[model samples]
Target chain A: MLDQAFEALKTYDWGTDVAVLAPIDEAVVATSGDSASREQLERRLAAVLAEDVSRDAKDYVCRKLMAIGTAASVPALAALLPSAELSHMARFALERIPAPEAGQALREALASVAGSQKVGVVTSLAGRGENESVAALARLVGDGDPAVARAAVIGLGRIRTPEAARALESAKPADPQAKLEAIDARLACAEALLAAGKKAEALAVYKPLAGPQQPKHVRLGATRGMLAASGKKAD
Target chain B: MGGQHQPTRRRFLQTAGAAAAAPYVITSAALGQGAIPPASERIVMGGIGIGNQGQWDQEAFLGRPDVQYVALCDVRQSVREKYKAKVDERYQNRDCQTYNDYRELLAREDIDAVHVATPDHWHAIQVVEACRQGKDVYCQKPETRTLREGPLLIEAARRFARVVSGGSQRVLEDYTELVNKCWSGELGPIKWINVNVGPLSQLCNLPAEETPADIDWDLWLGPAPWAPYNALRCSGSFATTGGSWRSYVDYSGGGMTDWGAHHFGGATFAVDVREKQPVEIEYIADPQGDHLAFHYDNGVILYHNRPKTENLAVEGTPGQQREAKPVPVYKGEGGIYGDFIHCVKTRERPFRDIELAVNTIAVSHLGTIAYNLRRSLKWDAAAQTFTGDEEANRYLDRARREPWVL
Candidate 1:
């Protein structure tokens, strides 16, 4: 039944059926409880990318692979990373693979579609929270897309590595939205900086967030950081 | 950091400097990593249902040097004129036009996003249409008046690439951190979450009163089941405190969706109840009780009809009230609004994005449907429908008046 659904989905009008079948197909694979059907779904998903079809088909296939959540499709999905049309789907699928190899695939694919796909690639990497992508993602924080930049801030915030502070500091700004986002990023950066014993610089980084006229979001977010930093200092 | 792909200092300065000037800065560094601008460079804001909530939106944006308050639309001319004066005072140099219809607002290319605080029934249509127009949205909580509206709103947001966040601000509260901690398994596995939502006194089989001269009765009644105007539902001249907004099922979903969105959306997020809808709802009523309970599939329960705890005293009891203190779900002022501004800049999902609110909405709808149907409801979370009840299924989705598709 799962294989039949997968095949039905391939020929299905990528427009209507793919959208309708996405969650249904995923649920079928999820509830099948049969190992053979799972492999069949995975094979169909990985190979569907190679077919000439609509963008929805690619997305449908990616969602299916994600639903399977297995490592076997990693190689097949990874191979499509160089295809710009399919790479975002591949990255999205790879993110759901839930294995070490999936992270490795994302890392290899990261440089392949460097400029146009940073947000998708970085968000996928962050979703995995793999340590290997930390340096790469931190660098992308300084990259040009606001969405990509914010995703990198989130990646650093999630990773909380010492090196990420310099990256955040170099990119920090007074922009309301960026400042709002950085409220936590600043706190995260402070924690990371403090962990490295750069106390004064950490405090300085959070001080302006305490000022009046600062956006309420920035002030609130920064105040929390200051409290945490101050508590650590008192201790 | 050193490679052929690296942006030059001059290029970095230009992009970074531009971000520096924007409300939500999208740095080259952050951009290179993939952060969609929190909002567009041009903040084309629109309003639907420009009454009190609409008036508040004008005040919210009026003098803010950061935003351009582009347009206002409401069903009533009086309400529109009142806010127009307020806005004109704020931006004396710029002319802000008012419209009696919301569809015309959707037609304006200058409008980039909309602030929807319309009546309960109109939410799904106006929001879905705005998304189709490629406008981002800030919609009030209880994203839908009914259960079926959730999937359509979610689909619309996905289809349009718009950022739709619910106005249920409790998701933005600090208490939310505690809730997230609980969900992350730090506060021990939550065996049961009791959500005490209301005082049920809000719904009254009240006698109808006179409709005011300045109101447009029919447009206000758009898509809702037909009912005559009453001062209680119209001017809300007699509601209890801040919740007079609840008197009309046409304008609001009583206390169920109003406070339900705040408490339920926050609790749903905290309890990891964001993905699925409730399996059953059994509303227990006693002649004297102030709250009701909504039960989910995972053994979690939300008690909405009364208050049980003493430390947290909710100022207003749910029924027929107006001018009450803002409910404290998130432990802060400006609950979801501040969080959204923050999320926009940071590009993280705020406490109540459309996706999260959809499930919150579904849960709210289930409670209302079960109450209206006056029976226990067996809901299928995956298919998002009720089992074995055709009459109940009809209430799940609503029919748009005309020309609206999700």
Candidate 2:
């Protein structure tokens, strides 16, 4: 039944009988009962992505994969990451799939893909909170493409770890615009620390940026963050 | 700190020095983000339903140093012109765009967010679409006119990952103090809650009137059941506080939803209800009486009517309890506008998130049905249905006019 629905997805239009895809839902639910069923469901969807078909079919399959895909499915989805057209849908599945290999696939793509596709892959890794890619992102933080560097900073912000902050604090961008995002990620790291009740750690992230030698704007933000961390209202 | 990507000191100094002279120095960076512009770069915004409350909101957004009103929209051309001229003169730019259709303003990718002060019936659709477009939304109080619309709007925000702050500004510390106090459990099992927002409305029966030229009557009735134009029922005046639409079941649920959005939006934050709906409701339709009451599974009951306190309060078995003093909004930042703007930059949840706002409004819609039937209704909160009451369940959503989709 799930295979029939997968075949039907190739020609499914927006207003098609929504029930025709009920098998896809049943397969997704069926996976939750055990790891074997989950692997089978994920493999079925991953196989669909490797087929020659419309982008819509891949998107439909990715939607199912988001709920059930695993490490076994990452390689098939990863192969599509170099395709500008299919990478987004691939990332959509990869972003929600909880597997270290999925993160590694995204990290490997950083040194390979270029332009917005690379930026988007960086964003996907960021969305996954991939701490292993911090060094790679720190390198991309210096990418010639300002948009990609900016995307890398946003990626670092989502990571919310001491290492991500260390890289963000040190890396300088060619684009003045990207520096603002680097500063933003630094603060995000502080905020996450503060939220976890690590006031001292949060203050460490704020104090240097709040220093008199820092840029006035950065100083102002860091000062506010420092005060807020120390139990004073800055807003 | 870098191999080849370091920006020159001269470039950094130029941008930083330029920012020193911009208006409202460092106002939006409380979250450490918005833009890197010299003090002057503004968050672009659009105002929909610029009549009374909408006009006031338009002015509020314009008043910020960090916000630029690129467009203004209202269903009535007269009101649109009135507010557009005000915005144009204030910005000293005559090119401020005006639109009769909100979808037009929403189409502009330059807009960072929208202030949706449309009528209650139009609130859910506009906010949902705006969020779906990746634009942050500030929707007015009584965020939804029906229960079914609530989940869809919430789903849109969730799927799009956009900020949606309900415009019930009164849920601030002025009201939260009491709810926060009660949630601490010092109130001792809160025997009863008197919300007292005022009365509920039944069917609207205003006499029909000729449609005015400046107003687009059909657009105003979007998604709502068809009704002939009536001056008292469908005018710019209805956008003001205590307007005719508030008394119409088709357009609104009267004061029941109006103050319920304010009181109930903050009630959960105060009380220990956490996040859940009332399991039952009883509605009575006397103009001067307690119009409705909702029963929670926790055995705490809430009543609606005009109350004496300026803020939300509750009754214990022995006495009344509230905060020693209120958490006052800082002088310049005193309303939902500041909170919404802050959330836009920080991506933190606003004071009144619309999903929670809808949860409160759904209770009021339950009240509206109870009043219409004049009977007690048992509700299954999980299923979102009435037990064996088909007629009552039908009131969860209304029939739409042709071509107007939910």
Kindly provide the TM-score of model 2 when superposed on the true structure, using C-alpha atoms: 0.54
lDDT measured at residue B327 in model 2 versus the true structure, 0 to 100: 33
Q: Model 1: per-residue lDDT, tens digit, A149-202?
A: 776775565455656665666666443334444445555667566667776777
DockQ per model, Cα: 0.01, 0.02
Clashing pairs for model 2 are: B179-B270, B180-B270, B196-B305
Model 2: DockQ score: 0.02
What are the chain B TM-scores of all models? 0.73, 0.80
State the lDDT of candidate 1 residue by residue for B258-374, as single tens digits: 666766766766656676677777666555753445667767665554445431112212232222222324222244554554444344555567888888767667777666545
Task: For candidate 2, give the lDDT of residue B112.
Answer: 73
Query: For each candidate, what TM-score against the reference?
Result: 0.50, 0.54
The interface root mean square deviation of candidate 1 comes to 19.0
Best-performing candidate as measured by lDDT: 2
Instruction: Please list the residue runs of candidate 1 whose C-alpha ends up more than 4 Å from where it truly belongs after superposition.
Output: A1-235, B1-40, B174-186, B199-213, B236-245, B282-299, B303-335, B338-349, B398-406
| Cα-based lDDT for every prediction | 0.59, 0.69
TM-score of 1: 0.50
Worst 10 residues of 2 chain B by lDDT: B1-10
